[model samples]
Target: MTLRRLHSLQQWLKEKDVAYAFIQGKANLFYLTGFRCEPHERLVSLLVFQDNEPCLIAPNMETSLICQSGWNYPIIGYSDSEDPWRLISTHLSSLEIVGSNLAVEKELLSVARAEQIKALSPELALLNCEDTIMKLRLIKNDKEIAILKEAAKLADFGVEVGVHALNTGRTEMEILAMIEYELKRKGIREMSFGTLVLSGEQSANPHGKPKMKSIEKGELVLFDLGVVLEGYCSDITRTVAFGNISTEQEKIYETVLTAQEATLSLCRKGTVLGDLDRKARSIITDAGYGAYFPHRIGHGLGVEVHELPSLNENNQDQLQVGMTFTIEPGIYVPKVGGVRIEDDVLITEDGYECLTHYPKELLVVKP
Candidate 1:
């Protein structure tokens, strides 16, 4: 699969008349080479030439791991005392790549690194290839879809653990820790993002941090989290009542749920992506909480939690089969709290499949 992905990129490079591509994004590296690593402050990159063989560069300590990851190409490992940029320049020169046009991930490359790449040769013309790569990754193959389905199942388990851990006196962080600990015991080493356990008024903050604030009766507790499995990711959000809640709170929850479901029902091949967002937004707006909704309806989910084809009010893109994304509609009313229902969705030829199916009915946990 990695070789096929690499071939696609190489074909793109050939079509554009580009000589080489310097891929530095961690996610992109994983997608193209089957090697995943947190390079940290070190430089880890894939140098792909249009006509020559590609190579991987990383810290000396990671070379073995890269090989174990099924990378069969030349790997240039650099020690801490060595200058990797200088070594990269020498390798490029050996390949007779001077004066050639190079493609790069403009969004991910840092200014200092870009300057170093520029210093390699005055005649090297750098072009942005981020869009092309994103377009390639937009549609998931059958293998990727199968992996994502497994990841989404794990995400459903995560939400289950969170719901079971809910209690009147338990702090938000306590539930958060329990959920992560359980996932870790299940062999999940990384979370797609920080697990959120926002309760009471704190939930009003769309991106609030989990706190030591105790869960109380008649409050809503929100769990927004995702797990990373085999380089793919799954995201889910569920807001449930801790105890018997106010009718106003119930209304807020139902409104968000209705909007989410309406938008999800609109998902299918050839459907206007932006209209989906509008469907949810209109529902929330009609419910008199449009001002409470701030962020986009959802984002593409795969190698990264957030990727291409953002589902926003203004986007005019159309959904295609094999495209996967999240459909999360939220309403965060200040002081009254918030409610969000999120599910990972995949567009199918006939319709769409809701990957994360942990139930959307409002669950009122007994105190």
Candidate 2:
């Protein structure tokens, strides 16, 4: 139940002289506590003290699920009519957490909630522990890597569903619906991100929204999607030819494929993170599509699709074994179509393993 992670946090608190740590991010909360829930407007958190048992503050309705998830710690559930922050203050006082140093997730905690915590302990020194938590979560454990591998298979399955659903004159939304429906039938509760199905010229927009526009013949169809399976996530993007295609279209697709492959080949232990982005960017730039390929190479993937160690040209982090991320390179033209090939990868001791095994070769579907 991630009790080891809890101990690690407590050790960090003791070293830093922090009294307590307030974990508010849903992803971080699930990572440390083994409990997953989205309270929305309601308050859901895990309070960890330096020298005491951790406490879980959650909605009364979620108590059973929290226990079922293997969390056997002290839980203080509050009804919607009750004040959660006030209860937290009382708990803090009882544990001698009042008027002491406190650490919190600066990125995840909202302004109003921070204000409420301050009201409870105005003299309390508030510190940001986001980086410390991120450092703990950066390198995936063996179990997390295994779950990510399964998730990668589901992500590849998602691409297969989307590709099979592709047809001439089919609207982008229709294909999106077909893909999502197929995933739901397979028991995938959610996608890592919104399903992206862009066809023809619409695909050139890179981040374009799926519309009712029909996918015409000889157009490029980009499928950027992933599925959340067993709490981990997998993201993949594959651009394919619809019916007949032109030489220019095929060249763009090939260039992007080359960039992805070259960047992936460099995903091993001790590799500087920025070099990966540079390798892909250099290939795209040498292909005369530098301006078209605008976005960073990729991002770290795990409980959240985007996480630590963003693969950008300026990042200085080094890739280590057990760290997982994506390597995606694309070329998007205005009037023309776009081509993006992405794969989830795991940095290994010697080389690397491609988690998402979906075919990146140009596939021309029958219309």
Best by TM-score: 1
Clashes in model 2: which pairs? none
In order of appearance, the predictions have TM-scores of 0.98, 0.98
Residue-by-residue lDDT tens digits, candidate 2, 132-204: 8888888998899999999899889888988998877789999999988988999998999999999988889
**Residue 350 in model 1: lDDT:** 92
lDDT of 1 by residue, 73-123 (tens): 999899999999989888877985532677889998889989877786657
* CA RMSD per model (angstroms): 1.0, 1.2
Q: Which candidate is the best by lDDT?
A: 1
TM-score of 2: 0.98
* Ten-residue region with minimum lDDT total, candidate 1: 93-102
